[model samples]
Target: MMGPAAMLLLLLLLFPVASAAGSRTLVFILAGQSNMGGRGGATNGTWDGVVPPQCAPSPRILRLSPALRWEEAREPLHAGIDLHNVLGVGPGMPFAHAVLHSHVLPPDTVVGLVPCAQGATPIANWSRGTELYERMLTRTRAALAECGGQGKLAALLWYQGEADTIRREDAELYTGRMETFVRDVRRDLAMPDLLVIQVGLATGQGKFIKLVREAQKGVKLPNVKYVDAKGLPIANDYTHLTTPAQVQLGKMLAKSYLATL
Candidate 1:
């Protein structure tokens, strides 16, 4: 019943759909500070010398570059987060691997990571309407657009609070600030039920570490969750997670994200 021209048009329309069939992209926003940017074993504070099995390369795992282009994800996921530091192993990749291979999401799904973490950044940096916050928003939007506007914001992974632990005022106000952050991020992204998985502090044992941890643990948002970093091993700097710890933390984060789904 269809003409040749109509059949040709139909085929053209179906081509893109068939090309994209059975392949979905799971987008995750990795935002926080230095630990989130990764600081694995380095040679003279430059270049990451360690790459664990959990952080191995995979074509299916992609990252948004500083130019806002999607590329194969590699270690030191946050090159756009900080220009000065050499990114090493972080929890982003391991988490992606776990989620992609997990039963929760489609096994054929491609994992997309939008890294926007900055080293030593405080929760205040992510305050709504601020420079850093605006930058994160822009980068996140760019990543979403890169997925042909078909991907989803699977989760916003946060691993900050160390810098806030340096001051009582910052720590004291962490809970309120974090509450605002969750609300604003969800509101801006138009995903009210967005999952926010916060990784509790393992570094910064002194100062207001306890207060910050309590604030992170006390968050009661609808879909917000926290992952404990207690007893996790740190690097020689005593502030960043070691290679093994990063792998373990990634798995823990993946598990937490899975529970929310």
Candidate 2:
């Protein structure tokens, strides 16, 4: 006895409910500075057109609000290229696909990466006092809401500290702040098992590297794990990772996360 319009609305509501009852979703957050944001040269490779089969096809990736100031690319390739000519790969795409390949993901899993990273931003900016963290948190919450609301945060991958290396006095404080940030995020997301992969800076920044390492080691969070990159090949600028380095870094990240599962 319902009108066509009303029937369509009922179907829309019921369809999502039916889908949710049987679907499994996992969301991953990529948070850091330029390295995690992916600054590297383009390359011709087999992964050029490779989109993770587990991810939804055609616009397989989505940018949620974009707290960072850099240009965004949904595909792994660099910006300013036609889809037909896509020939580059960013760290996120391969990393997510690797998770799928390793069978570490749940069935019907749709990996959502919330990239909140800026070039040259220090750890202090990511703290609670600044607007950066607030912006990232807002984007993160909105992304999860779109997916299905709370409990979607599967993991957080953090690769930062190059800018923070400039300030020696704040190194120890930075570690404490990181711990607090992780605790707050876990508490807010209500996912205590939310794994955190913190990648150490590979830019060869002097004493600060040691401090950051110590800080990561000292953090008492059981869910947090530090991924080492002590001898990796950083760019000639002495900061960013080159194209090959990014690929290696991505593989390392993928391996670490898979081992946990």
Candidate 3:
């Protein structure tokens, strides 16, 4: 079977880049743990500072910084937001680039990425009403308002679950937690049928990884879809995705999103 990287290349060869979309910037939320925040180049307490062209900065793709400012996005996107760690290549920019060029969205549409994932956070922390959850919502609303017009939330991209795999109870109850998180976000965002793309774990920090993985895949929401990252290359830590793999995951996400339309 073709691997994700090759499949992404195939998608590129098969589709034409779109050129027109709404005038308002389309936004997406990047939520989850360290992997989602990105630990690509931070293999040993430091980021290698390598930015692949796929994940490079662009005027069309923007990131909402920790201070809620929209800036031209680059690697290590969760710099201050996912505090207490070195950052590096993440799926956010790559996803944006792929979506920008894919038939999914117009090539000219501005993509706004809201980086709200914090390293070491578990699904429980993201439950509605918690500081983590409230903050994500607050930051997203602020970021959208910064779009200079009536920007719409295109979708939400989530990559997490490592924190919940540490114990039997957490792993077992993850289905409920995961379901609630998605449901609550949709409710609060007033986007009842929002497009949600969730990345399945490539690896985990605990033995209950299988359980958490199953829960993630079991979500049966209307527009919720899962992109497998199980076989993707991992970092030296065997947890977070590497730079190239992150790019592949992004394209995979774009493929999943485009399939829905």
lDDT of 2 by residue, 1-261 (tens): 999999978886766433332245455677776677665543222333434333222222333434322122255433331123223334665566566567656655555566666556777878774776776677677666766443266678888887767667767677788888888777776776779999877773445767766776687888788887667766555666656666677678889887887
Model 2 per-residue lDDT at 61:
37
Local accuracy of candidate 3 as per-residue lDDT tens digits, 66-175: 88877778888898888878888888888889888885565457888899998888899999999989999999898777765657888889998998889989988987
Worst 10 residues of 2 by lDDT: 77-86
lDDT of candidate model 1 versus the reference? 0.83
Candidate 2 residue pairs in backbone clash: none
TM-score of each: 0.89, 0.73, 0.89
Q: Which candidate model has the greater lDDT, 1 or 2?
A: 1
200 Cα displacement, candidate 3 (Å): 0.8
Q: What C-alpha lDDT values do all the predictions have? A: 0.83, 0.62, 0.84
Best by lDDT: 3
How far does residue 175 in candidate 1 sit from its true spot (Å)? Answer: 0.2
Which digits, one per residue and each the tens of the lDDT, describe model 1 over residues 9-110? 888566633223215878899988887888766424776566777888787788888888777788877766665787788899999888877877766678
